[model samples]
Every structure is written in C-alpha cells, then in structure tokens.
Target: MAAAPTRIRAAVVGTGAIVSGSHLPALRALADRVDLVAAVDVDEERLAAFRALAAEPDETGPGFTVTGYTDLAAMLDAERPDLVLIGTPPSLHRDQTVAALRAGAWVLCEKPLCLTLAEYDEIAAAENPDGGPYASVVFQHRYGSGAVHARDLLTGGALGAPLVAHCQTTWYRDTDYYAVPWRGRWDSEGGGPSMGHGIHQMDLLLHLLGDWTEIRGMAGRLVHDVESEDVSTALVRFANGAMATVVNSVLSPDEVSRIRVDCADATVELTHLYGHTNDDWVYTPAPHTREAADRVAHWRTPAADLPSSHAAQLSVLLDAMRDGVRPPGSGPDARRTLEFIAALYKSAFTGRPVHAGEIAPGDPYYEAMHGGHPDWAPAAATAATSATAATSAKEQ
Candidate 1:
C-alpha cells in the first residue's frame, strides 16, 4: 500500500481582505492536508481574528493550536512552516519572500510580486536550486478548466493561428479607495490599476497569447487623486504574429474584465469581473470555414466548471509541494507578467515602443517601475504627489 503524503505546515502573513476572504477559507477546507501553524500581521486585532478562523482541534487532529504574531521574523523562527502565504503590500513582498525562500519555505505570494524586476530577481535568486523550496506568484486565472481547453485548441492549431486579441480590465477605484496609505503608491502598492486591479486579466492574456515581442503604451491619472495612473493602455505584438490592445483602468463605473483572442479560423473570448467559470467563455468560428467551425464545435472541455480564484491556484501549488516539484507561477513563469508591465511603463515614460528583453540588468526600468527616478518621466506625476504627501505629513 502507498503511504500518505505528508501534510504541509503553513504560515500566512497579512490578515487583510485577501487572507480572510480567500486564503483562510481555502486552508480551512483542506484542513486534513494543511497544518495551520502561524499567522502574522502588523495589526494585532486582525491577527487574532485570523487565528480564531483556524480549524478546530478535530479539523487537523488533537492538540492543534495556531499562533498569532505581529512580527514576521518571530513567527518564521517559532513556527518554521513549510509554506508561507504572503498577502502583504508590494514593497514588503521582496523582503518577506526572500526571507521565506532562504529559510527553506515555499511561498505563494499575492501579485505584483515586487516594485521592480531587480527585486523580482532577488526573490528568484533566494530560492533553493537543489530543489526543496520555491516561490510562486498568484495568477490564478491561468489554471482554470476554460483556460486549459482554450490552450489545447490554440496550441494544436484547431483555431488556426492566433492573429489578434484584446484584453481589458476596466474597474472603479475612487478617492476613498486610495485613502489607504498603500493603495496608490509606486513604492508600496506598485503601479496603480495595472499592477493592482487588472493584473488578473493581463496575466491570463499573456498565458493564452504566449511570448510578446514589443509593446508601447501610455498611463494617465485621469480621475483619481492617487499617486499612480488610474488608467493605462498599451499595444502589444506577440512572437507568433498576434497583436493585442490592452487596457487596465479603475475609472470605469461599469466594470468588466474581458479578453478576446482572434485566431485565423475562430475567435475565442472570456468575460468576467473578479472570477470566471467556463460559462464566461465563448468560441466563434469563421462563417465561411466549415472545417474550422466543426473543429471548434467538437473541441472537448473539462466536465468541471473550475473557476479562477485563489483556491483554484492554491490547489495546483499544493500538489506541487506534495510531489516535491516547483509550483506553477514560479520563477520566470511569474516574472514574465511583471516584466510585461515594466516594458509598458518604460514605453509610456520614454515615449517610444519597448520590446521584450529590452529592459536588461542595468536598465533603470528594470530596477523600479517608476524607473530609477520617477520625476524623469512626465507620466509619473505620482512622484511629485508622493513628495508632496510626505511634505504635508512632516508639516503636520
């Protein structure tokens, strides 16, 4: 008889909305496979609340009690968990992720992994190459049943060649939303809507479309008084000759997150705001091409409705941990999404198109999303706003 897989000892950092809403629920559901060891948050009250949500003693067997800490270092030392979930702000991600990887714990962090590619590299460099611990960013949409079936169709050329596409994440983020200290800052939250809000749709687009060749775009602070662009638009050209227009915005009252890929023989699309099931996807074959229509119509899809969410992606990550394999969205797979955003910002700031592999080791954009100096670019007015905010705080 086969032996049972060892349960993972898990510690979660940040007891904020994402943790309480998604991470905790998923962890509790898998109580048998995960041991909740510790939770860390700056807010003691929030940490206490998260600790209460830990599974009852019967959930994970007897004598199970979760520890709460207001400091990360103390928790890492005392708990020594195998998996760490980082739901902290963007600025904290680099240091926290690096610390976890160095301590031989695997990590699945919230998105916009860090403020810059350099910091991204730092986290990647800290991973265990001899193959014990690793880190994965959260891009859950890439793992759903609809996405898998769509990839099978495109990769097999059933939809012919992918020619063009459109991806949009138009949502609303008002002044009240950015009232939080970290919301709109480059150093903390990363780029505004593109980094925080629309990253889900954008990452899904990259997953389906594959490698990009060149991209150019612009960012605007239009409506919100935040320190980052509330809206960003870009034109992207893929390595496979596919072109796409991408937009990430928080100014739309009628929020919709959508992606459409037009192939030589058919068009495939997905539309959903926060999460999506296979029902949100649609495929349309060219009217004149009978073979193409039949091929798409007969394409097989998963029997399950597997939707996009933290839970869905965590399932895949857990499997990797159990099997001693690198988790999905790890290293370069996750880095590509962040790289795309950097290239878009570089283009927007430089007033010229930027290509993949353009921002290398020494490139200022590679070091920071706002470049080495935010004020160097006119589009990055947030630098001035941040400075003004800091000044006002000092005066007060």
Candidate 2:
C-alpha cells in the first residue's frame, strides 16, 4: 500500500462565532489528518480565547498548539500553513480568500462566498491553474448522506424527473440578533435571507435538481428596520424542465428549513432546521405504480448516520488536499450556487426574469447582488410610510 499522507498544516482566520462554533470543532475532529497550527483575529481577546480553546484535549487525542495573530498576512508568512479556514463576514471573503490562495494555501470559506459574481471570479483567479491551491465555499449541506443519496436518485431517474419542488428557509431573527453592526446592512451582510440564510437550502436544491435556467424573484423589508429585506420569494426554472418555489424569511414564528421535490415516480423530502440527518429525509412512492413502491425499498441513505455539518465537508476537503486535486465547492462547482443567488437578486430588484449566463461581466448584478439599484431600499421605505400614515388616520 502507498504511504499514508502527511498531516496537513491548517490555520484559521476570524476567531468569531463561526470559527469557535463550527470550524474549530471540525478541525479538532480531523486531528489525525490535520494540524491546527495558527489562528488570526483582529480582536486580541477572541484570539486568546481561540488559542485556549484549541488547546482543549478531546477523548480521542491531545489538543493542538496554535499560535495567535492579529493580522492574517503575518500568520500566513510565519506559519506557511497548507490550509486556511476563513470564517469572516461575506464582504471580506473575496479579499481574504484571494490572499490565502495567493499565499499558496488552500482555502475553505464560509457561505455567501462573496458579495457578487465579479468578486467570485476574483477569488477563482487567484487559484493555481494546476489545481493545488484552490478556494472552496463551505456548503456542507451537499455532503450529507441524505443529500448524496437524493442527488444520485434524482439524476439517475430512480425518482423520475423532478417536476415541482419547494425550498423553504424560514427562521426567526429578532431585533437583538441584528443588533450587531454588520448583521443587517447591504454592504456588510450582502442580501437578506435570500443570500445569507436561504442560500444553504438553495444550494442543496441546485445540488439535487441540477442547473437552474431562469429566476423571477421579489424581496421586501416586511419586519426588520434594516437596509436589506427580511423576506424574499422566488420562482426558479431548472434546465431539466423542472420548476421550484423558494421562500426565505427571518420573520416566521414557525421556523423550518425544508426541501421537497415532487418527481414523476415519487417524492423525496428533507425537513430540518440548520442541519439534517438521514432520519430527517422521507422517500414516498407514487401510489399509481408498484414499481415506484419497489424502488423506495432501495432508495435509502447510507447506513451510517452523518448529519450535514462542517466536519463532513471538511473531511472531503482534506482527502482532496492529500491527493492534490480540486475539491468539491471549488471552481465552477462553487460558482454555480453563487450565480443562482446573484440571478435571484437581479430578478428581484429589476422585476424581470433573469436567465442563466445573462449576468455577465458588464452587468450591474455581476458586480454586486443588489445590482446597485437606486430604488432598492427607497421602494420599501415608501410602502412602510404609506402603511403607517394609513394606520394613524384610522386611529384618529
């Protein structure tokens, strides 16, 4: 047998919530294959906290010895890490990812990837053409056993052609949640739930349904007093002639993250919030045929229960790194999801159905998801003012 691959040296940037809660845990779980070498954060307190957290021993092994840095460049230069985990805000993803890639380190960045298609291209440009140092988006939902099984079935005609689907990501985020300075702004957080919260479900939808052909969407600032919309809805048409409805909201009391696909032979559904296991998926056969029922018996997820999480995706990324190949969530595979998000925003703001390949280099949407629409926030403000005045008059 070939020799076991050497342990990969890894570092993390932004010791914020995502790093502490998600990425760090993932790194520790894969300790046998990776070394948590360093961490970077602007805040000294958070950096120190991360260093302490990294040193905590787990049941399987001892902890890591991670050096802390206030500057990413300093960490990159000093450590010369093989992998870099970026958990910063969406606005900073492009620059930071580019920086890591340029430093000859592979990158796995958190979702939203970047603010626009143009920025995504910039990140892609920084990669080595030979495929050693690539930047991947952290879309862990696609790595789940349920999703993998579903995508195989859907694409292989096991469930027949997907006809109609619904992708919903409705979760509550109150005033205190958006109290953070970067939570609600367009420049900081990118778009609303459509870009931030719903993108995960949307990416999973695309992963199962294949490429999307067109999108017609609408967004509104229904509840939140912020620069971005609190709720958004869209109708998407897939290249396979299937259509889907997508609803993303942060104002719903009954929170749910669900995707249901109605195929010609049967229906497959996944219902959960944030993450899901194989048990969360249901495969229902069409009542009209016995063959559909028979296939349902074989249409099952892997026996092992691997919930969709950062660890699952990170494990795959580690394998790819060992082999020196491009990994999932990199290059075109990652760009497809971000492109769909850009199209949704363009269609919502422009009030037109956006088709694939339409938002090219020069299009405003290519530069930013909002497309720099001058009327984006003003339109919502106008409606809110009108509603408030009408309510006041009725009270008088």
Winning candidate number (lDDT): 2
Query: Residue-wise lDDT of candidate 2 within 272-292, one digit each (tens)?
Result: 998999999998888864565
Q: Could you tell me how far off, in angstroms, the CA of residue 42 lies in candidate 1 after the best superposition?
A: 1.8
Q: Provide TM-scores for the models.
A: 0.90, 0.92
Candidate 1, residue 164: lDDT: 88
Give one digit per residue, the lDDT tens place, for model 1 in 254-347.
Answer: 9999999998888899988888888888888777665654465665455577877777787888888877777778877788889999998888
Q: List the candidate 1 regions with Cα displacement exceeding 4 Å.
A: 1-5, 55-64, 290-294, 372-396
Q: Cα RMSD for candidate 1?
A: 5.9
Best by TM-score: 2
Q: What are the C-alpha RMSDs, in order, of all predicted structures?
A: 5.9, 7.4
